[model samples]
Target chain A: MALGTDYAQQDCSLARALEVVGERWSMLIVRDAFYGVRRFNDFLAHLDIPRAVLTGRLRSLVAAGVLDKEPYQQSPVRYGYGLTSAGRELWLPIYALARWGERHASDGGARTVFSHATCGTRLDIVGSCPTCCVLVAPEDVMMRPGPGALTELRQDPVSRALGRPHRLLAPIEPLSETVGEQAAEPVG
Target chain B: MALGTDYAQQDCSLARALEVVGERWSMLIVRDAFYGVRRFNDFLAHLDIPRAVLTGRLRSLVAAGVLDKEPYQQSPVRYGYGLTSAGRELWLPIYALARWGERHASDGGARTVFSHATCGTRLDIVGSCPTCCVLVAPEDVMMRPGPGALTELRQDPVSRALGRPHRLLAPIEPLSETVGEQAAEPVG
Candidate 1:
């Protein structure tokens, strides 16, 4: 709660939650992981964070039990970061907050619309499947651009891949290392 | 979004939402508003924020339409901040995120518990009343110290008032000016 304290002094659960994800780019990093961006390179390409900050966030998330760091490649020892079961519980808050943004944050337009993967019915304001009348888990949800979708706003490989309709939590295979470098390269 | 960017460059609603409330202390300010701590002194007493920082957050929240700045005392012209409709919608995310913390962030015990003011049924993970089978709005929710609550952690008047069961959005009348100063005094 203090300028230097990580809100540890507050005896509130919200304070505890914010201590974990309230860092500048931490929530966005968690959002990226939910979008199935597992590799560090892919997250870097999709987000505009510096490499060092991204590294710290990933390490912190892993340490907090929100993300699991696993090796996906042996030739170069590449690592993939995915949400743990506890981390996956974060989907509710993430979706609820993101949907709040969709309704009130931007102009009266939706950028990404979420739907029930099984029935294809769009979720309600709180991520509940109106047709099924139950809250839909992230794995059972699907995402795609909506009325405010800007396909060309970002040309990064991860962004391009995200422009398509995809099931939440399913890994979006990151492009090859060469293509990834090209996308991450400074445009200037 | 870029580092300098308030996530304005992103086409997503989540980015827009973050732009308004992602700054440190913003969400906590809003949380206090939901708990009926409206006056500047009450907020200052409840939160461990510097005076200038709290002032800035209040102004920004007013500019963003999350809080309304209204004159409550006219002799010296004191103002009170209350949540607007848009701000009230934040309860979904705030409550959900806090529940997530109660589950994963702390030692398996809840510091605070929320329930439907009408039925007294505890809210589900998503802020839904299991008995009523509907999402409980902020005004309909009641908060109380749970089994894990540490009542002595904070003795501020605002915190003491919050220690008792209270409804969301009802004002917690602040102590008189002299009592406020006594509580705000720095300990030797």
Candidate 2:
């Protein structure tokens, strides 16, 4: 979907995705929502993001269907932000990024780690196995575009690039492992 | 570790990660590297990122250990970029964000989907078992901060405010199990 500025204009799915969440304070707000912070004041206090920018981002997110503005109380003051169903699903991205930082960019001794409640051990962000606990590989996975693909992808680039009958939900290859190998490994 | 900035600065790891990756086009550059775009000219052609900004971001990322500069060819044309182990790991964040966009922000038909190659079924990005296909939960997880944590975290405002001992990386909490319920899952 096109945003107001062409700065975010790109036909790529990732670019299309970034148009909404790629701004500076956008994901941070999402992070707070995960922390169960529903109040606007709490977001401001925790993030230290400028009020105007926070207001604008919150508005944009609300407009984009990522947040819902609701009244938390009445009388003197009443209001807060809550993640819509759409907004809450962002957990993967946030966790993935945090796990990445925890592993690659971290200073070696992690101050925190993510434990898998089921497995009862800290899970590797990139490769968590529900069956056997080991790192998985790309050939181990494939992808079909979700329900959110654009017409341009179905008709143009994907069709021209891959020459397959485009089922937006069809399984394509997992390029991460193949391309990632040359790039390096454990991309968490 | 301190970057010479005041320890009182924002102590959010996501923010610090953003401080590095959140710059315009940095993630895109990493994305391009995944696509096998190595030369500066290739990055210029692919991203349309301003040369000065690209140069600066590349230099900074190199300095920060994400990218390694190597001589691909000599005789006047002597530079190319590649992912160090550090850079390769950035895929998690990019994938995470893209997944978020697909689920929350993308219009109908706007998102991409993933499937496990072994199962030939859609993969849940959050906290699913790769083998048994079981979903993981928040109480099942734990958090120990990573190496990149700010020393400021031990200081007054941040330390006191965020004084919780455990930094939990739980499976995003589930909301209602409605059709779009995945969209509302919260992570912390």
Candidate 3:
């Protein structure tokens, strides 16, 4: 992808941030991680990316300290990837961009809605709770599919599992082994 | 850069946002726009990007409604690109990402410091003023070169002009026509 030139000769902090997370599939993977899709199989099922690409993104994220890869099961050495503190800090930028898209880019309305988990009030454009008058932390935010979500476009088990309301950063249970295997095929 | 595949099958708002501004030099252009870089020659001088790439990015941003190109001079039909309301909405995400970079990516401290223009208090990590106890809008924020700024690396007139504190979104004067012609040469 010629990602190496992501920010050539730019001495700005934004350029540095982009250098780490600006790759094609990188931010989506981080988004999935925030959605609690920890395991490789879950990320593979939820995102339409090649396995090698996903692996490479995950490796880069881990190396950059955005995600931590740790053994979840030792029998065959399965690892789970989760957001680090640095990664959790990305929630604001991610949410801000998503809200901007919902306002400007989408005719389908909000595909997903984020709210203050405690008060159940939808977050403002900047990820703040209007009712509480404070910025909602990602951990304190809950997400649910909104009316604009295209359910028909997604059939993977992870998508189905995400239909219900979920808190950001809470681990998602793996889909059944049968469903996982069936959805393992990568889509271009 | 194979940027074509950035949002291949992604149906999320973040993906939509990235699709528009995720190219190699797009966000930096947007950042420069926020810093009052309206003239083409000023953008060319401030950003170390190829002239063709900068032109392409500016055209795309204008098409995407993030920027508006307007005639600033009638004699030569010269136009300046300014951020639209939708583009100004990007301040939160841009500031958030830059703050994150300053926190985690840079060892040289903040290259630039953002402050509340009204009270002159530096903004918090979330771009809110601690003294004002409110979120500072982009226009109300001021930026100044910080101790860690690498002024030596940039000799562009825009860089020199930015050395003094300036309010975000205030128009910056272009270099003299002769200097503009001299600095028009693309730098690698």
Candidate 4:
């Protein structure tokens, strides 16, 4: 599909998605939080990100509800960051990408292997039945749009993604029919 | 475990992973490319990223072998991008993260949906068995150092990740191995 213009000018679902989480360091911060790195210092130590960048990312994430900032200690103590339910849920995508990078990006030697904690069999992020050994493809899945989608924003990207074929990480279906027509209109 | 240091500087797998793809807009750029976005202007239209930023990101992705740049049309002599075998493999992690985001970040009402072209069922990125409906957890997965790992690079992140307990998104195994050694050193 052709990339349309005025992405910033449009209020579309993908755009909305990008607006919140698309900035630099956002996902990494979320990824670090999931790995049990709870403090700002831990994020810095783990990410090699500049302090300003980390701080900005953290603030944005908290504002976006991806993270919950709580006080871990008091007096001379400090606040620790943790994933809210929202943050915790990002595990799948992070794992999926990490597994992909490990499998494809490495220099031909196995860089890392993922195993099933229970079965002891190496796990595949996109595998079907470790026993049956089927690989899952995007077209095999469906997706439904989420809440942050524009109420009155309908644009090409959203239309094409919603109506036609696109490579999605998983299967998604639009949950709300009300979103269809109303979302297509331009939002002030 | 801690959050306040240069993680990239430390001997950590997550840090190394970040070094490769941790910069802002990188993964998303990869994601859009997979969605079939091919041109510079298209990415800008789709991502709302600054033109310079888009150029830089695309260049980095190409350099990393995550994307390939070729001429889409010779009339205007415009270039287009497509995934190499290496790029397509990123689907694993992209799916993982998208699933995580949809489950955790999405409100109960789906804003959109994805249909697996293979299964004909709406699939979640959770690595669950559709037939059995079992959810797979990170603890359920394990990673063994792979072939690409450079044993000669004693301080490599992959080496460190293989050495410790880490989630798919963030590898924390190096802390005890690397930091423990640091802690043991004489504190002059």
The per-candidate TM-score of the B chain, in the order shown, comes to: 0.88, 0.56, 0.89, 0.60
Decreasing TM-score order of the candidates? 1, 3, 2, 4
Candidate 2, B16-114: lDDT as tens digits: 566667655777777656444567865675566679978988997898788889886678867888877778667556655655655554545433343
Every model's DockQ: 0.61, 0.15, 0.62, 0.10
- lDDT, candidate 4, A43-139, per-residue tens: 6655567899888888878887888888866897787777776665555555565555444443333333333333434445554327535443322
Q: Write the per-residue lDDT of candidate 3 for residues B1-188, one digit (tens) a residue.
A: 35533564666888888878777778889999899889988888888777998888899899999999999889879899999999998898899889888887777899899999999999987788999898899999999988778877777767766777878998876443343333444335
Candidate 2 lDDT tens digits, A119-177? 43444565455455754322232222222222232222212222222221122223211
Model 4 residue B133 CA deviation in Å: 10
Off by over 4 Å in 1: A1-5, A174-188, B1-5, B174-188
Docking class of 2: incorrect
Q: Is the docking of candidate 3 incorrect, acceptable, medium or high quality?
A: medium
The interface root-mean-square deviations, each candidate in sequence, come to 1.5, 14.0, 1.3, 15.0
TM-score of the first chain alone, every candidate: 0.89, 0.60, 0.89, 0.57
Candidate 3, superposed: residue stretches over 4 Å from native: A1-8, A175-188, B1-8, B175-188
Question: How far is each candidate from the true structure, as Cα RMSD in Å?
Answer: 4.9, 23.1, 5.1, 23.9
- Per-residue lDDT of A64 in model 3: 87
DockQ, model 3, C-alpha based = 0.62
**lDDT of model 3 at residue B44?**
88
